[model samples]
Each structure stands twice: as structure tokens, then as C-alpha cells.
Target: MANLIFPSDFEWGAATAAYQIEGAAAEDGKGKSIWDTFTHQKGNILNNDTGDIACDHYHRYQEDIALMKEIGLDTYRFSISWPRVLPAGKGKVNQKGIDFYKRLVNQLLEAGIKPAATLYHWDLPEQLQLKGGWENRDTIYYFQEYAELMYSELGDLVPRWITHNEPFVVSMVGNLFGEHAPGYQDYNKALQVAHNLLVSHGLAVDSFRESGIKGEIGITLNLNHVYAKTDSKEDQQAKDYCDAFNNRWFLDPVFKAKYPTKLLALYQDKFGGFEIETGDMEIISREIDFLGINYYSRAVVEYAEDELLKHKTIKPEQAIYTAMNWEVYPDGLRDLLIRLNKEYTDKEIFITENGAAFADQLAADGQVHDQPRVDYLREHFKAAYQAIEAGVPLAGYYVWSLLDNFEWAFGYSKRFGIIHVDYQNQQQRTLKDSAKMFKQVIADNGLTD
Candidate 1:
């Protein structure tokens, strides 16, 4: 049994997205999403794995909720599929989509769990992608419309709403880097996508307020607290480049009504300063209720001085890495939370997504042995505990995943889930050691050595 240890109100939960979990790919008026198309394409995903039947969560949500209850979760964070809502990404709302979410929301509420809703979680409608996706200004209006529709429907039940989940990733990986859906590799398009996403965020936030919904609204950012390899000035500058690329870009607009000057200088001619009309910055600069910080690990900087690495990415020398090849550094989480609280926005921060993907399997007794994940989260949760103790206004903690669902292009190969899901049989789940450890942390209300 978990010891009653957290503060009176610290939220404990797990998160999942529609495209990653809900299988009924083309069912009940659901239109195609970018992920659907991307997964269907050969060579686009690992081993040509698709999310077509991922965990079968659509039919197994009640089972999933039951698992959440059994694990003693206090909150549940889930995303609304854009294509499922508005099949074409614009015009004519689908009742079926709302019905799916309503069922999920009702289930969460019935289980005495708070519902934290994410409006967009990287599953852009395929039709929207055909029209340039995030690069086009038109998509912003569509997103806001969708947000309004959600608030109109499920706002009464969900007390917290996340506007966009990792806009930086949607733009950087999907557009600039071409590693994700609707892949494009133009730096200019990436910049435009960033600007457009921020605008959509602004529009959505404003629209949410206008809807008179009584809830806290914010955005989630996948932050990598970068550290200089040494005290050298070049390495410091490399860290600065990494910061501007990851945190400062979206943060500046949300908190300061201005994009980071450091970043603008680096990508000026490439994207022409993320063009903004009158009052656009003001719109983007509105006060947010909180900032969701998804801290996995930090990047160590080496001064590459080359034009390519100089302004783009900070190369790390760390031998330790994730299945996604990301370095494992717990101190990075503390550094990032402290930096954001001190140097950047003073908003309430939540460790939204902090979990490691490792080679995991179900043991003979139905227990998943994910020791690396347990270690990763324990270290990071300690860092998060430090953040809260340091007066960072932290409110809650939710692990990256509830189940081992489709992990984008990496597919099922990456297991970031606290619970193991058998993709072949679409069987429900088994709690991992990490999940038990998390339960211990939650029960203790804080990290106990």
C-alpha cells in the first residue's frame, strides 16, 4: 500500500494521447490524421509499425480507467484527436468525436479523478496538413474553433485545459527536422510553423476566456535544460543556442509578447523574424495560468562553432542516452525548473512528461521490469521535489504515459509507459516497477531516500 505522503493537493496521474492509444483509426466518423497517413507510409515509421490498433484503447477505455483507479491515480490527462472532432480539421463538428471524449471525461469523473484535457497533441487533421498545416495562418483559426467547440462541450467537467502539447516539437521535429508527421525540412517553414502555433495558442487562450469557461488553461513544452560542457565561453554560447531553440522561442512569446532576440538574430533571414501584424504579440503575451514543463533530461553543450551546429543544435558528449537517443541527466530538470522560475516565467510549473523509454518486458508474474525508467523518474522526481522546495510554484506531476502505446515513428519499440500494454493481443496492462515506484512517491507525497 502507498503511504499517505504527498501534500493535501498534489496531483498524481498518467497521460495519454488519442493517436497513440485509441485504435479505431477510421471508426465512427473519425477522419484521417497526419499520424494515420504518416504511419501508413512505408519507411516512415520503424518496421512500418502503425497505430491502427494501438492498445485498442478506444474499446478498452473503461478497462484503462479501471487500471487507473487500481493504481490510485488522482488525475487523468488525455488529448482530443483533431480529426476525430472535425474530420476535415474545419467545419462541421463530429458528434462522434465529442461523444468519445464525453465518455472518457465522464469515466474519469466517475472514478473520482480530475480530467486534465489537452486540446491538441500532435495529431493534426490530414486535411489541414494538405493546406500547409501549422505553416498556414488559416490553421490557427481552425484550431481556435476546435478549442471553442471543446470548451463548449466538455469544459464544465474538465477543470484544467492544456492548449497545445509541445508546439516546439510539432514545429521542430515535424517541420524543421522532418522526423515526425507531415515531414518537411525547410527552416523557413519551421519558423513559420512556430509563429503560427504561438498565434493559435494565443487565439485559443483568448477564445477560451471568451467562452467564459471556469478553468485553468495553459500549454505544455518539452524542455531540455542544457548545460555547458565546461566553463568555456564557447560552450556557454552553445548552451545559449540550445536554450533559444528549445525553451526561449515559445516561452518568450507566451510570457513576453516577443520572440527571443537571441533566436531571431540566428534565424532572421531564414524565417524573416516570424512576421507579426499589429497586436499579435500582445495576443500571444497574455498571462497563462501555468506552464507545463516536460523534463526528461538535459543536453550537454560542446562548442561546434560550425555554421550548422553554431545556431541549430547543441551536440552532447554524454554516452548515456534513451531509446530515442536523448541523454539522461537528472540535474537538467532542476536546472530548467529553477531557470524558468528565476530567469523566465514565474508561472506555476508541472513536470508534465518525465519518463524514460527502455527495453522492458512482462515477467512471469505479469510484472514489468523497467528498472532504467524507475531510476530515471526517481532521479528526476527528486529534482522536481527540489524545484517545489525551492519555491517554484509547482502544482502536480504526471508521467509521460499510462500504457505502452504507439510511440510515433519509433512505434511500439519505445516503451515510455508506466504500464505495459501487449499490442498483439490488445490486452489491458500490468503495472511496471516504475509504476509501483511512482505509487510509492505519490503515497509519500514526496521523494523519500
Candidate 2:
């Protein structure tokens, strides 16, 4: 029996990014993306693995969509590859690329599934990277142009559009930490990139509204509930700074139209200040219809002397961790939803990405008994149900992935999909226990025992 039932109208879905799964890197006149370049370089990805033929989703999307239909996904959230559509990242539209997505959207519709499309998912066109990418203000307008083009091409079909996904990872991980594509290790450059990403998001929203598209537009941010490791004032300050750095820095600009004053002063004192031109804040704070949040795990922070942010996340001892070394904290999802409702906008929130990477092995019987992943999703779903009961207006939930594909810099080393992918065996797919569990969750519109 299942007691925690979601609202009858609650949306259920699975999300996937094109670059991560759609392997047709050079097919259909697609230009190279930063990932294509990054993965090809020496010592960048594990085993130097590239997504050259990842799951072959570009050719196998129909098969994938059939699986989605079987799982009863009410919606399919996918990202459009920037280079795939606009090979040069601007001008010279790739009709074949556009046609691919059109076919994808049409199939989802035929399957009775809504298409929620994301414009950018960290796959900056290689040509755009050559022009300084997000750090360059010109890139903002280029993104707007791409968004408008997509709107004109597929706007009527996609009722939900996400402007950008995880700007924090794009700016911080890719720039500040040098962990992802176009890897840069400069603090000021990262801040500039962050600012430009927000500006571009606003411009896209403005364009969507101008096009009179019958749809809702929003940005998806990877957020986590932050906590202090101890009751000490130093730890509390560290927690606040970490929260500001990860959450408020992006949230405030989108919702409040300004950066957090405390952290803004600190950044200004350290690295000059984020470039803010006239009317930039006004545009950045444009009203959006919903907020998409990607919650994986909570961060626990403690004071650290001689650190840039004066804080560092610390792992709790003896805590359960995912294959990605992330602490599994389902309560964080509940807490984050409640906090967003209390402090951020009143718009509906969607768990745009939520799932765990586990060490999965396919058995001789062509089955994957991934009970841990099923357990992980169950707890997270319970937390989501709790958030809704608390009046958080949580409208939907999209599992982080519908298939196992490239895991970025980690290459194909990690598995986050509920469906097991046999990369060595023709990219064959088999539903894990977790996938079966999720199917029931969708069918029941809630968790089950």
C-alpha cells in the first residue's frame, strides 16, 4: 500500500541532456561543442573516453521514446545541443539538427507526453568558446538569437521552456574549478561568466514573451540545503557564505534583481565587482512562470581560514554516499523546497534533476537488481510528498536521467540511470529495479510498498 500520494495533476517525468546522450557529434552538419573538444584532449576525461557514440541516442531516440512511453512518463525534459542546431553557435541554422528535435518532440506528443525543452545545458558551441564564450557580453545576444530561433521553430510544440540549466556548474565548475569544458581557473572570469549567463537567461525570457509563445519559461538551478557543521559562530558564518555563494548568488539576481549585499561587498573588495551595466538588473529579474530546482544532496560547511569564501564543504563521517561521493540526504530536498517557498518566488517548483549514480551490474538473466537506487528514489519521493503537504507548490519531479550516458569529465565511469546501459554490448538498455519501481510510482502517482 502507498499512503503518500501526489496530487492527481502532478507531473512525472525524466530528463536528459543532448550532449550526454545524443552521440552524432558530427552527424547532421553539427559543429563541435566545447565538450567535443574537451573530451578529445589528453588527460581531460577518465580513460580519455569521449561521447563520440554515447548511447547513440541521436540515432536511437525513437527506441528511447518507446521506453519512456512504457515507463508512463507524463513529460520528457530534454536539452537542445547548441552546436547541433546552430553549428557556429550563431547564424547558419542547421535544419537537419532542428528537424531531429522536431521529430523527437513529435514522438513525445504522440506518446501523450509533454515536451519540456531546455535551451542550454552547458554545451557551448565550440565557435562560441573561441569568442570567449560566456565571459564575453556578446555571447548574451547570441544566446538570445538562438533561443528566438528555437522558439520560432518549435515553440508551439514545447509548452515548457527552460532557458538554462545549472548556471552555477557552468560558471563555477567549468571556470573557477577548471573541472568541465573550456576549463578556466580564474575567479574574476568565473564571476563574469556567471553574470553573463544570467543576463542571457533574461534575454531569452524576453524573447519568448515577445514571440507570444504559448508556453512557460524558466531557469533550472542546481541548489542544495546548506548546513553548518557545528553551533559555533564561525561555522554559522561559513554556512551563510556557502549558501550565498551557491544559492543566493543566482537566486537573488533572478528573483530580487540584485546580488546579496553581504557577499557582493566581499566580492567587490576582493575581485573588483561583477560587471553590471545599466538596466541589466532590471532585465535579469524579469518575472518567470516557474522555478526549476535540481537537488542532489545537501552541503555541510565549516569555517576555513585562508580560503577565498572563508568556508569549505565538509563530509559528515559515517554517512551514506552515492557513487559520486555525494551524501544522500533526502530531507535536504524537503528543506530546500520549504525554504524556497518561504524566501524565494511563489511560482511552482519542479525537481528538474534528481537521482543517484550507483555501481550497477547486469546479471546473466538480463536484469539489474539495483535496490539501492530504488531506495534512494523512494526516500527522495517521500521528501517531495512532504514538501507538497507543507504547501510548497511543488508541481513536478524529473529524474536526473532516463538513460546511462556520458558522465562528463568522469567520462562513462559513473552510472546515474535507472535503466542500465550496457556500453560494451551495443549500448543495450535494461530496466533496473529502480526503473521498475519508478514505473509503479508513475502509475500510482505516488510511492508504493
Candidate 3:
């Protein structure tokens, strides 16, 4: 078999969120975030684990960047903690917080690794949440202000900026499902939150252009292809609705400047609809330089009369499963990429987040024999190569994480990093076999069969 080669300019890297890795939670006059509040509450996160000292990256970023250099990464994608910078989410800059990110960016540059910064990754400042959070339109401007601050401070150092990471997850999981921070159990609220997030994203794009920053700006969405469980019309309809809910609900607004008509009608009829201010859609549809996608698995759905979306996802027993219980469907990435290219905007695409978790342990030789993770990444890389072959302008790939820090609601139960972190032993970092494989892939820019 021929070797799967990527474009010569293809970028390779890894990603991590601030709250998940940079644990100096309350140090340096940083304000509390929703995650901080949620994690502290009992019966919220698994194992009662919190991100209080996750990976201790705040004090160990130098070491982490050294690891990134050792991995031969072309770039490193990390998020900024909202509360870390703006203690009240809008007013009064925390110089310490701003200084910390400056240090991190400078170090990445020194290591010859380009830095990609994500403005938001679900860590809303607790102070803002108290004021109705994203449900209130005022939060949109606050976010824009925050965006401007980041741009003015570090825009010259970081060339790539992602406005938000997975707004769907931020709205649906955090609001509707009540699994994440600022937990609320109302679909109506979730819809409002989602709309506000898009508005804020648009405002951020506007700010970026206005600031005359030379960096590229985009949003990272968690997108997956939806499949019908059967040939029945009911299943097909369910698939369409699921697609609208998961993919098009966000995609259409950013790319086409409109919501899916059917879903919009259903939402209006069922929940009285969210308020779409005049010109909001136009703002949300601002032209972006690229589209960042986080593809992990596919969705297979069947119709259900009593279901909320009138659909229910069905898991196939024949599929391989990740530790997160997500199916390992590499072909879904290829199909999703092709579909996005044929249907969505013509912007250059990047896999901003893609990786899986498995139950692997350190062996006697002080090496982690994570063969499953190695295989998982290899198959996904092949799928990405196939997407590029199909004329998709795939420009880069960033693994889900560079360290096994905090895993959110599931806490530290799920490990999604190539480098294992020994939390019990002062967060000792050890590169698993998968990391070794990735280093080679980055060096070769391809994989051999």
C-alpha cells in the first residue's frame, strides 16, 4: 500500500484548555469560573475530582513547551481562562493572568512552535454567570471586549485564533443536559445561550478585523456526520433533525447566515423560539479565514415518538469504543470533511481536536504501551489523508491534548492525552508509545502502511 502523505504545508500539533491544565486556580487574584464553582459542588463531577491542581501547568508551562518541542510539533493550541484575565468577566484586567499567557506564548515561539489561541473553551467567569450569563445580550459585548483585550495583548505573537471551541457543547451539555458548568436544565435557555455564543463569535471576528490584527480567526465546532439506523422514512427524518441539531444549527449560522428552516419552525412551535435581534444573523455570518472542526465520532439515529428531538441515537455493537464510550469511526471524519467541503464554506479546514481515551497503564520499563491509542491515531491520520486526497483543503491537525490533565464532568477518569500524567506523583509526565508514533508522523508528514 502507498504511504498516506499530507500536504507539505500541513501543520501538526496538540491542544489543551486552560482550566483543564493550568491549575493555579485561585492564585494571582484570579476570579472563580463556572467550572470552579461546579467542580466544588459535591455530586457533580466524577470521583469528586476538580481541576484545582490539574497538571499544575500554570507553574510548569516551561516544561510543557519543552515537551512540545521534543514532540516536533508545528504548533500548539491552548485556551485562555476568562476569569484569569478579567476577574469580573468584563472589567479590571488581571495583570498576573495576562502576564502568564504572554509567558506561555513567548515560550512557544522560542521553541519554534506556533501558538494557536482559543478565546473560550467553556470556562465562563462565575461573576458573569450570576448575571444570566450568555442568556443576556449584554454578555455578547463583554465577550467582544475580552476578545479585543486578547488581540491587543498577544495578537502579534499568535497567528491563529479560535473564537470558541464547540459552542454546541457549551450550550447543550452545560445548559440542556446540566452535565457541565453553569448547569441549567432548560432547552429554551440552551437555545438562547447558543445564539448568544454565535453573536459573540461574530463580534469577535469583527473586533479582530477592526484591530487590524494579522492573525487568522475562526471557530472550532464539534461536527460529526449523521447516519440513519434504517431505510425507513422515520429514521431518515430523525437523521435530518439530528444533523440540524448537531451540525447545521451552528454551521448554517456561521456559514450560510441562516438557521435550518425546519428546525427553526419546530423550535418556535415547541419552545416559542429564541429572540433573533435584527442583524444578528448577518453578524454571525462574517467571513472567516478558516473553519476548525473537532471530529471524534459519528451519530446514528432512529426515530422515537417520545424523544425530545424525535430521535434516539443507537450504538452499534460491532463498533470499537473509546473509553468515553464514543465509537471509533474513522470513516466518519472522511465523510464529514467531504460533506463540509461540498456543502459549507470554502475556507481552509483544520482538525483542531481529534483523539481518543483508553485504559492504558505504565509498563515495567517505565514506558506506557498504549498500542490502542497508537492504532486509533494511525487510522484517523489515514482518514485525514483520504479527505485531502478527495480535494478537501485540510491544512492542519491538532490532537485533542498534549497532557492527561482534567477531563471535565468525567473528571480524571478519562485519559485523552499522548503523554500520561501521574497525578498521584506530582504530575510526572511520561510520553506514551502513541506520542512516539505522533512525533514520527509530524517529522515525516505522513504514515506508511
lDDT (10s digit) by residue, model 1, range 396-442: 88898899889987988998899998775547588899888887776
Residue-level lDDT tens digits of model 3 in 374-448: 999999999999999999999999998899979999999999999999998889999999999999999889996
TM-score of 1: 0.95
lDDT of 1: 0.84
lDDT, candidates in the order shown: 0.84, 0.94, 0.95
Task: Give per-candidate clash totals.
Answer: 3, 0, 0
Q: Please tell me which predicted candidate would have the highest lDDT against the true structure.
A: 3
Return the lDDT, model 2, position 166: 98
Clashing pairs in 2: none
Ranking by TM-score: 3, 2, 1
TM-score of each: 0.95, 0.99, 0.99
The segments of candidate 2 whose C-alpha lies over 4 angstroms from its true place after superposition are: none
- Candidate 2 lDDT over 350-401, as tens digits, reads 9999999999999788799988899899999999999999999999999989
Q: Put the candidates in lDDT order, highest first.
A: 3, 2, 1
Give me the runs in candidate 1 sitting further than 4 Å from their true place. Answer: 1-6, 309-319
Colliding residue pairs in candidate 3: none
